[model samples]
Target: MIKRIAYLTSPGPTDRRGVAPGIVTPGFQMEFVQIGTPTLVNDPADLMITDLAYVEAAMRAQRQGFDGIVIGAVADYGLCTIRASVDIPVFGCGQAGLLTAAGIGDKFGIVTIWPETTAFTYDRILRDNPVGRQCVSVRYVSTVAEQAEIADEDGFYQQMQAGREGMMLRILAEIEAAVAEGAQSIVLGCNCMSPVASILAARSSVPVIDPTAAGYRSLESMLLLGLTHAKDPRLPAVSERGPAFAEAVAAVVGTLDEPEECPVCVLDEYGNASCEAPSHEAAPTSADGTAQ
Candidate 1:
């Protein structure tokens, strides 16, 4: 059984509320690591900066002998690289979100944070999965600028207050919106939004998809299956001097000039993107002044 699991994330209220619980659930011992937040540079090419940070963090965790690693971000930032770099299994919240949503119903809608990210995420999902047609819709709660504003301390507090005060109303509106658009269930698409998931579900008739719960269950299953942190034998070792492999690593970590296309992007029926990448970046500063 998997006794120990490592949960890596950027420092943020969202991560604390959504990702941490997945690690410490009943049967597992969890270790949480904080990394840098992924800042959106003017050039899209700089996206690799965030991706590389996650890989570096995973390598650190693997060296420390964690049983497995879970990248705890709604975006699933650097999943592919972390998986390739480590012998242990690496899971992403985004994948958990999709898998969880799928288990409950035929179609689901995602309520994510940024509009641009919604588009980018949708693109990634379509590229990764063969069954890209199952998603119903993926909507953004706020634009990137708005998200950034709310991510700040005062803004976050106000947003939280708004959510709490108008909890039922917001939940009802979101549910009605999704159902009207043909969603059988709703997936809390943002990590920050997870704390309110059960509240949303409690107020709605349909089910709510909680990525944290999904990720926790997935880790539990991996433990039960006795999975090992062994390298995939199919892939050649770096010592084998495979230029392509080296190039791929270089493409992912070398520079901010060109961001490699994430390999795990896939689509569900509703056109919502499924992220399988692990995040690499500094953790966001938390309002609570505690490490998330």
Candidate 2:
């Protein structure tokens, strides 16, 4: 069963809601870890960078003997790759909240932080799932610029509390609007909104699900049941040394303009990356040795 759960917040390490003081439970515990990379994620390019950070963070948690990893975002940024890479169960707030909403309500709506992330909610959480049909609308509390400013600031937690009362009322309005639009339930689309989750849930008549909490509980329950995502048929792994592998190693750990080769990325008996001597590049030698 899960004794420790790591909640990974994306693209940065500024959030302190669940970290500084931390949260406690009877049977297990949750530790919040910042991705500690590109400070914020506003678009697909940002997500590309943050995705790698999140996967690495999850792996680190697994290495530390954590039983489960809960990605603290409604986007579920690296959900697929993380699950494929780790042995423990991986939960994303987006999937967790959406699934929960589907189970309890005939129809639901999503109130996320802002516009750019709203796109992610539609693309990742709603677009493909049958539950998408039940998600009537995905609304936002503010503009992308507003969220970006807060995310970029050093005092993120303080900024989030700047107009706490106003933010709550705005979120409450969104929930009421969703209910008017035939929503039987609502899911807060961003996991970072945990600070105000209780206020939103209390003021709103229909259920206002806190995605972070949903994901946390989901992982905890899965652990108790001895369950996790299917990893059979094994996920993709790099078997050859190439530009692709070299680029990752460079970006993450070094400054290689273009390494000729990278250590062969092979999965050891435990599904861990075990490298051997290099020289696996696919560049072909010409018939004339120097020319084609």
Candidate 3:
């Protein structure tokens, strides 16, 4: 039977959008939706918007009866929250591509668009994967100027076509650098790079993995095996906080353009919550485990 999967996008998270083109395998119907206001994910404010948007998108996809959901960004925003919220197979492009490369090669290389953000995110996520250390090198591309010119799908396609050769050369150079650093496989770390994945794969000595393709194909394989995430330890819904706390918190953080100050005198007025993190400089003795 043909299964349905919702490919939820983070919009312009890295000045790029959606999965790399032409990676879908057969036997599954896929729906692509830009789930949030486009944001340049390297920016803290913008990244936060895309992060929470994934949670809402996953809930909607599950409610709509989709068989699976793919977080389209290679950075895989809100991966944990979405997986916990929904029972369906939630494929994160980063994990899919990284794990795929890990399985096939001794060490994989990542080439991303942004310099700092992706490297940091990959470092954090790689910790949870046993073979995460196998990701040897992460090379970055400086494509902000060109991507900023793109405003719509027509423009994006036009840009990709006009700059295809140039983009390929730049990416090819990065792939070479990764290989020099002992990367056995190259994983495209940005969704925008997906279009030229085949081109790079053909020219490069090592395998070139497109994260979008890996993620979609992973979800497809999971369905074929009738596998889904474990239902235990679900993200339990919040039934009650209070009209005061809910209203106050929402008013303070309702959107990206929220008020600088809490509208309700202070947040502690609601539920005794503080914007402070408990001091973790030293270990705590109490069983309740509030940090010391």
Candidate 4:
């Protein structure tokens, strides 16, 4: 059985908040690990700033003994490096998103945050899997300038509201265009859209693929595979440790004995509770042992 898993993400507890529940739903007992401190980059020249955060996450996951590592960003920064540095499988939300799309339909459309990143996202998809031809288009909802306008307000509620509305319209338009252009499904290209995918899908004729959930499900499959072939050298041994590993150990210890709220559902602006974490109550434990 896959008893433990780790989710490595960039700092900014709020940013981490968006993807955690997707990784720890029922059927999996996984710990969500955060790396680095919160960072905000306003200049396009500094856009790569998030890369450092992911690198830190990767290094921490390697030091601490994690069976697998899931990078939380949709941009998938440091994915290659993380994979190369770790013996265990390192999964990225972006890659999993693409794979999920391919599995569910002939073609998929990506809805992203920045227009400038569209090119980057496109290039990454193509380079990672040439099969990206199956992807219809990567659309951006909020450009850097747009996000800048509301980056500081109260949760950026007003801007996010406007952005979400605009995004919904853009997504609907893109879905219509993609369908007309031969796409059979749409992929939510950003982690923020994950909490609302089911709502989007419910209102649309085609299916909505949430990259975060897709990534989590991908990790689940890898865990099952690793557990099945317990002797595979590809799997990392559980005794790994390093000086920088204490944070991950602490994170696991903090969560293992407590019931964590569903991160996705909790962060949803709509107050929807569809995406919840695995119920700790259902976790099997001996009468005398604490639930993990």
Against the hidden true structure, what lDDT does model 2 obtain?
Answer: 0.60
Put down candidate 4 lDDT per residue, 1-292, tens digits, no spaces.
Answer: 5445666653323432435464575656666666543221223222244444455566666566767777665666657655655666677777787887788887877755444434554566557775578887766555444433332333322333344555566666766666776778777666656655676787767787777777767877887776321234665543243333445433433443333333221133442222212233432211000000
TM-score of 3: 0.71
lDDT of 3 by residue, 90-204 (tens): 8877788899899887988887644433355566557756777998877876443433323333333233333467666777888899999999998877655665667789998
Write candidate 2's Cα lDDT for 1-292 as tens digits.
4398887863222332342233445778887665534222334544565567667777677777888888876767668878877788888777888899999889999886554344643565586466778898887766534533332333222233443676677778888999999998898866556667777788888988877678788887898899988775664531222334335634753332343211111112232222212222332110000000
Tens-digit lDDT string for candidate 1 (30-95): 767655432332223434555555566677676677877776655565677676667777777667
Candidate 2 local lDDT, residue 233: 69
The per-model lDDT (C-alpha) reads 0.54, 0.60, 0.59, 0.53
> Which TM-score value belongs to model 1?
0.70
Q: Model 1: how far is 30 from its true place, Å?
A: 1.6
Judging by lDDT, tell me the better candidate of 2 and 4: 2
Highest lDDT model number: 2
Worst 10 residues of 1 by lDDT: 283-292
- Candidate 1 runs further than 4 Å off: 12-15, 18-23, 36-43, 116-118, 151-158, 228-232, 236-292
TM per candidate: 0.70, 0.73, 0.71, 0.67
Order the candidate numbers by TM-score, best to worst. Answer: 2, 3, 1, 4
Clashes of each: 32, 0, 1, 0
